[model samples]
Target: MNTSPPTAIVRGATVRFGDVQALDGIDLALTRGALTVVTGPNGAGKSTLLEVIAGTTPLTRGTVDRDGAVAFVPQRTALTPRLPLTASDMVAVGTWRRAGLWRRLSERMRGDIAEAMERLAVLDLAHRPFAALSGGQQQRVLIAQGLVGRADLLLLDEPTTAVDARSAELILDAVAAETARGATVACVSHDPRLIDTAAVVVPLDGGRIDQSIRDAGRGRPRCPA
Candidate 1:
């Protein structure tokens, strides 16, 4: 049994937008150094669950308690072609959480950014315009942004979707490496490869949890739904 405290805990979480309920009574705990995959059909509230954990979405009821820094990478980002931001610039956004907007990045921060891009196999794309990159390249760059901070809690939505096999492999390996380095990783993905390797699998439907499955070979026991 891994006795370390959970990185984050969501208790009795619920979210409602007018007549639509996005999440209902979700109770979950994200284990340190473990990967938890959230899977479900469209409108299953999977993304909403991540938002709640990221503290970007407010709950209609219940509470969330979390520790350390959090990095959230959404499924899609809108970057204007007119902005002229390079791939390296996009990855550098991850450092802003700790470095703030105005402070110049230290040498170590720059190194970390470079390391993250390399891990995602996007180091070569660093000088290219972010908006000009292909879908796979853009996704890889965005994930590198999430990794540059070495956040305690890393949240990603559908990271491998619509990407080439090589890109998908790089993304999966990078995510796995984060957990290996003791980050709590929760990702929303339909990829069977991710699901098979996840420490915990969370299935949500109609704004409620169907169940929580902890792989017999990974992490701790199953969390109560």
Candidate 2:
């Protein structure tokens, strides 16, 4: 079994938005260097779970312990046509965490950004206005932005939604590569293509984890307690 320590752990996690409970006590451990796919119906708290792990949303109750830097690629981003930002410019934002504002990007950082864009197949769209790109193209660019950081933990929400078949394939390939490189990846998706390949599949319902299926046949163990 893959007995390595978990990359992140969430215990007794509960999130309430007024009268609505987004998550009911959830205990989860994300295995390091594995692809974890969170699947559920709409409003099943898939995105909320990811947000909790990303530390962007505070839990109403519970605790989360995580390791290393994180890179989150949200499902959708709205950019006005007037923004005048190019695709490359959007991807370069990933480097800001390390390079910071007003600091020139080092050669390695620049190369990382370029490599990320190329892996997502958006390198050719580098000079195009971000707002001018198609939905699939924009999605790929956002993913590239996330990848450029080379964060230890990568989280994505519905990355393949509304994307073309080729784009979806490319996105999946890129995330899989991240896992191969020992980065922990958690993706919220309904796409069977992703679930079928995930080392761990987590299904949620009514804001609770229904089950965690680790591909034991492949020698992967269940989420740690």
| Best candidate, TM-score | 1
- Steric clash pairs (candidate 1): none
Q: Point out where model 2 deviates above 4 Å.
A: 77-83, 211-225
Best by lDDT: 1
Q: Mind giving the per-residue lDDT tens digits that candidate 2 earns over 58-176?
A: 99999999998889887775345455799999999888888997799889988998899999999999999988899999999999999998898999999999999999999999988
Position 212, candidate 2: lDDT: 56
Q: Write the per-residue lDDT of candidate 1 for residues 1-225, one digit (tens) a residue.
A: 455688999999999999999998999999898889998889999999999999999999999999999999988653454557999999999999889999999999999999999999999999999888998999999999999988999999999999999999999999889998999999999898988878778878887777553345655333433
How displaced is residue 21 in candidate 1, in Å? 0.5
Worst 10 residues of 1 by lDDT: 216-225
